[model samples]
Target: MEYVEIARAESERGELVLRERRDENAPTVLELRANGVFVMDTLETSTEQALASAALALVDRPRAVVVGGLGLGFTMHEVLADHRVEKCAVVEIEPRLVDWMRDGTVPHGPALLADERVTVVVADIAVALAEAPPSSYDLVLLDVDNGPGYLVHRTNAALYREPFLRAARSVLRPGGALAVWSADQAPELRDTLAEVFGDAEAQSHDVVLQDREEAFWLYVARVPSDA
Candidate 1:
């Protein structure tokens, strides 16, 4: 395996160390870390993309969306591909990841960062969630942790709890959609969604990264209409 030194940068939070490792026979790996905690990379983003798309697909009039994670802009890119998406608010926890994407260290470079509909918020996603009015969005996609179980950051576990899920529903229009991507299927998360949203479904997809495979599931919940 050939390892490439990428960059060591700083965000509003702490230092971020990035690296690219390429195996002789496998796909190139882009690794990211914030204050020494490992974040997401270029391994597999199928579920990420699906998280955004699934939310959109559930809403017939989805004009605006808030994506909680901006890991490689794969989910944002997928959302923008839809003509119906008029606005997108991407909230990223780490500011350094935005710099890495802008500086071309993350492969796609300026092309990914220069999109018109995107508004980058270099703050906690919960900040945006706190400020958004009720029924303001048609869709909400969260990729904060590895799902509800394996949190990349300990603080993120709260975002997966029932209260946060209801908060997600609070900002979405009646019958609007909420989609979440997880590394593994979380039954407890599913049950929480069921209790809060009234209608919940799970969709699974297989992700292949560096010849290693894993199954990812996107939990989708829809706010029910009284009618």
Candidate 2:
């Protein structure tokens, strides 16, 4: 199978590449890459879906959601699947990524961008989280990089640290949940979430790829209603 380059852009974080690959056994797959590293592909998005579903399940009537990273819009789309979600704020650091999605360069682009309840912010997620008012959202889902261990850019390491987690927590309403999607299990991250949220659990999702079965992780933490 041959992968054709769909588009490329020099993003602030790194070089962003979008490509399409076709296989005889599967439908056309769109892939998103950053700094020459594979971010995600449209073929299988269970981890992203689980990131939204699992988090929303922990919150009651989640009216507002903050999603960090807009990879192919899978996470955002899954969040919008729930009718209870009145506002879905997505923060993407790469402006070109948003442009590609809005311009139909990506398959899942237009619908997500056109959703009335969805707001796409072309800014760093950390900045967005820092500027968010306290108790503003019902949920915060992050899948900015593969995980804290596999960041496309070294600077993104801050997102998975103690301070960033604290910032994310401050933006969530009482009893709101924070969920993060990781390509692999990170016990350290789970530990950090526990330290910040008082409690945290890691949910593992089994995913079947073309050649093998793999697992992803979703770390979830909830704010105390009294806090």
Candidate 3:
């Protein structure tokens, strides 16, 4: 098991590194690290895919979607897989990572971004949500950090709070849903979602990775149909 560094960049926040792992017996894996912390990889993308699927299921007509993060593009990829999705807006804070994806540093990136339904916005999701047109999206899927409990950046904690949740809700069309992915069981996050969306549910999933079985959670809430 060895990792070969493919690309690296330093941002004001921290360093972003992309590495490739190759084993004669296994498929090549692309790993993304932010500030020297593990972010995500191409090996096991089920969790990300599940996040998109579950969120999309909650909306009766999921024509527009906002993805809060674009790590490796797995989540967005899944969102595009649904033909019902006509527009996908991806807000990513890391410009370098976005460049890598556009420049073919990430193999699957160009194809995913080439989708006519996709739009990439390089900015903080908070700012993006703040500036978005009201009732513009049918679904808002956030995977910016690992979760509220496991944050790669301290400031992302604001995302799980009422103020930010309110902004997320404001951008959703009536009956639209918002979903957040967390690496840990975030009871507090579920509670916050409930507070903001009136009612929320948390779904637990067991993902069997190459090394171990990890538990992931998805917190989901929907706006009232009449609202």
Candidate 4:
């Protein structure tokens, strides 16, 4: 296995790096790292794709969606795969990552961002959700950090707390849904989502990564139709 540095940028939060992974026997992969922490990779993105698919499936009208992170654009790409989705607003905190995607530093970045239904907003996702108008979107998918338990940044911990969760809820239209991806089971987050949205469910997705079977969790909650 070998890693070739593709691009690196220093952000206020930390250092962000894009690299190409070349394995002699396996296909090449692109990986993203933040502050030296492995963020995501192009290897198997079943979890990311599942995050978007499950949330969109729960909504009766998933025409407008908000994706909290733009790691490698896999989640965003999955979101756009649904023709029912007319708009996808992606909120990313690091400007350099966005620039890389736009300028082709991240190979699939340009093509993914070029989708007419896609809108990129370089801002803290928490702030973006807070400032958004009530009932602004039909679905909100958060893959910003691994989860509240495995945070890439300490500040992102707030994203799982009550206040920020409420903000995410407020931005959803009635009957809309909010889905959060976790690297591991976060029982507390599921409970919190239940409290905020009146009900929530957790789904486990078993995937094989690097020849190891791992389990990822998705927490989903939907606003009532009459709300």
Candidate 5:
């Protein structure tokens, strides 16, 4: 495969190096740190799409949506694609990812980043959730790292905990849903969500693009409004 150096590696965290590869098929990403840790790439995004689609299926006439993680903007794109969505806010902890999308390093970056309906907030999503409007957003989609099974940043694990889940629940509108993407089915995560949301579920779906070699986990938790 022929490749061009569209963007070079840069360190956001202590030893984390992020690089973008522009090739004929698509411009993808590579993230590494002190160890040989890798994050994600462009070839696969079934979980991202599934997460967004699942939440969208539950919410109707959603005035806004909050998406955590800007990994290639696949989830953000899916949320914005919905005509019923009036506005969308995306919170990304990594500034480099936002910059990468801003400068068009990856495919469709500019279109997604500059979309009038999209508000890209460069901050930790947990912090953003602290003040995100109450009963404001109909959906909250998070794919910040490798999900509940694997995490890119250690602190992100809190996002899967009760306190953070309650915060996310607070920001969500009644009947709104929070969808988290995981690399593998997490029964523990399912239980955690059930404890926090009072109702939660986990579903597995196979991706046609992955040639059946891959499957995605969709964890949906609903925040019910008081009648």
Candidate 6:
């Protein structure tokens, strides 16, 4: 196996690194790391893509969507696939990650950034959600950290708390939905969402890697049209 460094930077949150690695029998893979924690790569993005699809499925006509994290742009790309989505805002804490995408460091980055309906916001997702007007978005998808159990940044833990969840709910219009991606099943997160949204469902998706099968989780909560 051979590894090559692509780019590295320091963000307000922590250290961010991008690299490419190639193996004898496998294709070259681009990986992203934040504060020495492994984030995501280009190997398999089914879970990220599923996050968008599953969330949109719950809404009738989702026009405005906000994605919490913009890792490799897979989630945003998937969100744009639905013609019903007229505006898509992606909030990323690290500006360097967005720069890498804009400069073509990530393979699928250019196309997603080029989309007219997409808006890239370089800011903390929590702040963005808090500042958003009430009932403004049709859907909100969160893929920032790994999950409640594992956090790339300690500060990100607040995002899964009751307060943030409530704030996220407040930004959703009636019948709008909020979706979260977790590297593992998070029962506590499900319960928290249930408390905030009145109901929450956890869906498991399986992705086959080179050596094993991994189960990723998605949590979806919707506001009733009457609410």
Output the TM-score of candidate 2: 0.95
Q: List candidate 2 segments past 4 Å from native.
A: 24-26
Model 6, span 109-178: residue lDDT tens? 8878999999999899999999999999999999898677788899989999899999999999999999
**Where does candidate 3 stray beyond 4 Å?**
none
The local distance difference test score of model 5 is 0.77
TM-score to true structure, per model: 0.86, 0.95, 0.96, 0.96, 0.86, 0.95
Model 4 misplaced stretches (Cα beyond 4 Å): none
How far is 94's C-alpha from truth in model 1 (Å)? 1.0
lDDT value for candidate 6?
A: 0.90
Instruction: State the local distance difference test value for candidate 3.
Output: 0.92
Give the winner by lDDT: 1 or 6: 6
Off by over 4 Å in 6: none
Q: Each model's number of backbone clashes?
A: 0, 0, 0, 0, 0, 0
Per-residue lDDT for 204 in model 6?
A: 85
By the lDDT metric, which is better: model 5 or model 6? 6
| Clashing residue pairs found in predicted model 2 | none
lDDT of 1 by residue, 11-70 (tens): 445677888879989888887766677776777666666677767888897798998988
RMSD of every prediction: 2.5, 1.4, 1.2, 1.2, 3.0, 1.4
Identify the superior model by lDDT, candidate 3 or candidate 5: 3
lDDT of 2 by residue, 111-203 (tens): 779999999998889999999999999999988887888887899899988999999999999989999888888999999999999999999
Point out the worst 10-residue segment of candidate 2 by lDDT. 204-213
